[model samples]
Target chain A: MELTNYVVLATILFTIGATTVLLRRNAIIVFMGVELMLNATNLALVTFARIHGDLTGQVLAFFVMVVAAAEVVVGLAIIVSIFRTRRSASVDDVNLMKS
Target chain B: MTDSFVAPTIDWIYLVPILVVLGTGVVGVLVEAFVPARARRTVQVTLALLATAASFATIVLLWRDPAVQGDPATGGTYGVRVLGGSMVIDPFGLAVQGVVVLLAFLAILVIADRTSTGQDAFAPTAAAVPGSPYEDLARRKGIEQTEVYPLVLFAVGGMMIFPATGNLLVMFVALEVLSLPLYVLSAMARRRRLLSQEASFKYFLLGAFASALFVFGVALVYGYAGTVDLAAVFQVLAGGGTPFADMPGLVLTGVLLILAGLLFKVGAAPFHAWTPDVYQGAPTPITGFMAACTKAAAFGALLRVLYVISLGMAQSDPAAQEDLFVALWVVALLTMVIGTAVGAVQTDVKRLLAYSSIAHAGFILVGIIGFSQASLRATVFYLLVYGLATVGSFAVVTLVRETAPAPERALVDATAGVVAPGGESASAPSAPTGGDPVGDDPSPAVPDAGVVLGEATHLAQWAGLGRRSPWLAGAFSLFLLSMAGIPLTAGFIAKFSAFGAAIAGPDTQGGGSTWVLAVVGVLASAVAVFFYVRIIVLMYFTAPAEDAEGVGVTVVRSRGPAAISIAVCAALVLVLGVFPSPVLELAAEAVKFVP
Candidate 1:
């Protein structure tokens, strides 16, 4: 039951993130969505570790969290800078690097 | 998080390079966050340089350690299996990584120089002369470009980890490690305005999707194999007792999905639609770095996944594997054909090379299809040749960006910054053109060039570069030649080795596949020559368009790191082209830990 609940929660968070990333206009909001997905992955990883009775999974999860944290710090900084320069965070509003 | 599990002992000696890079990156960020804006550039460049040098030292140490020699066990093939079976240390990983790091640094140098025009090379002045608009231009375009180095190091750390990762989880981490920074960096180009941001967003969305696909594939493969250990998968296939036919569909699906994800990273044909736009829009340095390092790492993982984990199954069930190979062959050929055809017509240098890289990916995959762990030696060899040449090409591209005087700053301030009394400024001071006894005027009567910045087109701006900066032009020419695979250059040697290795197929210990694909590879490469030379002809032979700025003349001069990076990269390409054995031998032995 515990395992199932953890997975369900992870799924819910991931879905929410996906929806926000797809639907939101704010670039920062999309970034938040990305963060949500990353966090969901972390939770899922820990849940798997509990199920497996192994600490390796947990260690791996720790690294994931570290990486995710770094990413957010950098991503948020970049987004903020872009916001200041371009003055709008909407995806539709920004179209510079498009291929 | 768990006390019960015996923690794997940390090997700082092996991991020292990574730590050094991360440490430097963090320091660089702090430097940015805390330092006054004027002094930040010095902190950024110095921190980046020191970190790179330290990590490079660690890499040298890691490369020399006898323990990592030969084919050490990979943490296992399922990519999620821990420790031994997923990632194997070998010359291939080390060689590719070195290429990645070197390429990353070159890009840092390029962005630094190109974006810092007119301002003090390192530090930015806080205020501008009244009515002159010099300060305003700097704020809008030059100096303030301190983020380049930190982002470069961060990307290097990711590239280092990308290929060295021993497990699927680590691989995913490595992918994002490099990618997240890239997504942000993409939006920061100084030219092409909105298109740069668009590249970042598109790359982010696609990259995220690919990551999702990759993870799902890993889960499926784990589910089917009942083990994430690559060795176990190999053992199951090679040891011969397990019945693989029972779940052929699952295995096939898992492998394909995994391939798709890796392919996305490499910008292989079906997934390569974004290359042209992104390369054209973002800062040239970043594009060069992404094209070389990211492609190398992605291919590194893909090579390991397909060749190492899936080979056993392929050998066991030759039909399934051969069918898969055939499907891939079609894609490779199509990519080659399309890339060559498209590249030939491109007027933009960045877009042309973008297509060229796409074609090169196709050629490299052909090398992959011809490779097997049994002939693993050749695979690594081809990767080296390909990796070096690709980075070398991008380095040249960075050098070609035109340098313009900073749109901000009084010539007097710039002169003071450069030819100051003692050269004791906290950063790289601008060339003090202030000694120009002739052009020194403090009058707004000239009308601020900043406010009238109506059409400072890159191409039009660079029309008379030969007359203005012949040294930059000459260096760019060598780079283009090297890129074109001309004789007496590293590109030629690199391409020669790849083609030779591919045709020799697998291990060339007397008996190999005789490289039937060499002819096709050669022909495709010949097709590529049309465009490589076309760009050269245009650059060296054609005159800048009349009145310039016909939407094509966009030449932005690089001042600091970008200049140094181009010089270094160009030197390396020429040097390596003439003398290729030492690096090759080092790469040959980078896998001692793979037993």
Candidate 2:
């Protein structure tokens, strides 16, 4: 398979993830969408690294994974605290301040 | 083919400032783990402040280093690249680092301050549900939030690294490192827990999305240039070192995406959906810190990126350069209009300040669009003065509190036939018992600790503040006037330099269209003045709202730190306004980026 095809696949997944983040009501699901978008970027980075014959992209992917894990730790902790108080994880329900 | 591994030689001395800050953060975390709870706040505050001070001293040392000063004959500054060119300590980056450290120190003072009641701004137990028995128990036990100091130090460390890096990967890491602590901090407000958490949730999700786009943009740029190093990418764009140079579409798309991420941090319009909400909901001190330091760091990074891309495009693709200019122009115009128009209507003090910050971001963008050394100096100066005013204003906000009414006093005043200044019967049954008999005294009877509520953020609550506490009102008025760009205040000089830079224009670019932004910025300042002046009038001219309902504003006496921060900020604003040449010269000297 052509390497460009990998980029195309990544783009499709990224779109799906972005759309989910915008449209999904559940905060957890929205966070999952963020994760998906990140993973899609990882795929693209690795593919680009293969094409470039350099280690930078691969190293960046590893960094992204670590950051994503850190995000999960902070995100889940915040979500759980909010969930305990309101008994709901819906983003719409979280609206206390008028935007 | 097997290759022998070679470790990259590092410059340890040049990396000292960043290391000291990040190192302090790690030790701070260790302090949290090992130190006894009673002694933790003192230890952490001392460590964080001293480390930040030491870091600033190192930056000063670097400034004087002959290597950094470069050759006097050339009249050019040199940047030191460390860690295989991942980080660059250039004049511009160093100046920004200094600004961030200075602002962070002041913000930490506000964050560390407790009211005379011995209540700090953070929740006793952040994990406990608001209003729950556990929360009450923690509150009663007076369990101080010693952990906040460490979190703030880590955030400050990330902020220092953010503007100094030349590698996209490292920038991404720095972005996350800075943002994560802030997300946690936003959720830890002692009052308005729900709003705080919601702000944190929104900030995290949106921040994550922006960074995702940023990383993807890095991937695309890497695909085109075969490297994530900014200097390398610039070289490829300028000299066509890559086969993909012909595909400007991919590179431009990536550049815009990366810009989106940076713009989000700066709270520019179209990407600023989170700023007002987050600023309004976060604890006031954290809001002040985020507003001042984050914007400076983001602008520093943005300036570097724009300089590289524009310089490269000038050499290789003038058409692309024009396109970039047009894009920036539109964002600047939109940001000014939205910030001014929307900000004029906000009733909540915090939200009003948030919108004002947005407008200020637009003014800074005006300086940026000029794309010259003069503009760069002006932009840096604007950031410094704006930061001082913001931190000072928010510090003032932290001291203003809402007092619950004392029912007995209301009845007593009613029978006495005493009427307050606003024609509202001062004697309404709901008047606070601890309140003075006249009801006009700005100094409320220091209510019992339990009765004192959160910040008096409602605009109506601030009525007749000048009559209550003249010194605080006077200080707050100075910040507002400075923000309004009135004469003889720091803000006026800042606005003047920024607009002047835009009007002067860079020699390479036709600066005609950029002047339109300056005109619009001036007009926006006029519109912005209305709101700022309205607040001043409300504070000094309007009568205190009839507290017959018992929710009057009271100025809480700080133990010491917040007051000192405010006094320093106010004094600096006046001094900078009066004599800006020294700082302007400093900025002029520091305008070069390492590229």
The candidate that achieves the highest lDDT relative to the unseen native structure? 2
Candidate 2: count of backbone clashes, pairs at least 3 residues apart or interchain = 3
| Candidate 1 chain B: 10-residue stretch with minimal lDDT | B437-446
Per-residue lDDT of model 2, residues B1-595, tens digit only: 5998989899888888888888998998899899998999999989888888898999989987767767688876588888866888888889999999899999999998987756777888889865466776787688878778888888888888889899888888988888999999998888766678778988988998898888888878888888888899899999986657788877887788888889999999988899999998788999999999999989988888888878888898888888888888988988999999999999889999999999999999999998888899998999999999999999999999876554344443342222222321231233233433232112224645224556888888899999999999999999999999998999999999999989988757655667888999999999999999999999999999887455656788998999999999999999999998999898998897786
lDDT of 1 by residue, B1-595 (tens): 6668877644455667677887788888888888998788777877777777777666666664555542246533211112453344455566566666666665555545533224322212222221224634554454576766777788788877777665676677778878888887776654333355556666776676566556545544543454445555556555544333356555666577678878888887887877787776566667777887788788777776666555666666666666666667777777777788888777566777788888878777766766644224334544544444555455445443322234333433332111222221211133233322111222121122211111121333334545445666666666666656687776676667666666666541344443656667678788888776665555556676553221222333455565666667677777778887886566445432231
Indicate the residue-level lDDT of B127 in model 1: 25
**Candidate 2 docking DockQ:** 0.48
In model 2, the fraction of reference contacts reproduced equals: 0.61
How many backbone clashes are present in model 1?
Answer: 69
The residue-level lDDT of candidate 1 at B239 comes to 57
Global Cα RMSD, each model: 9.3, 6.3
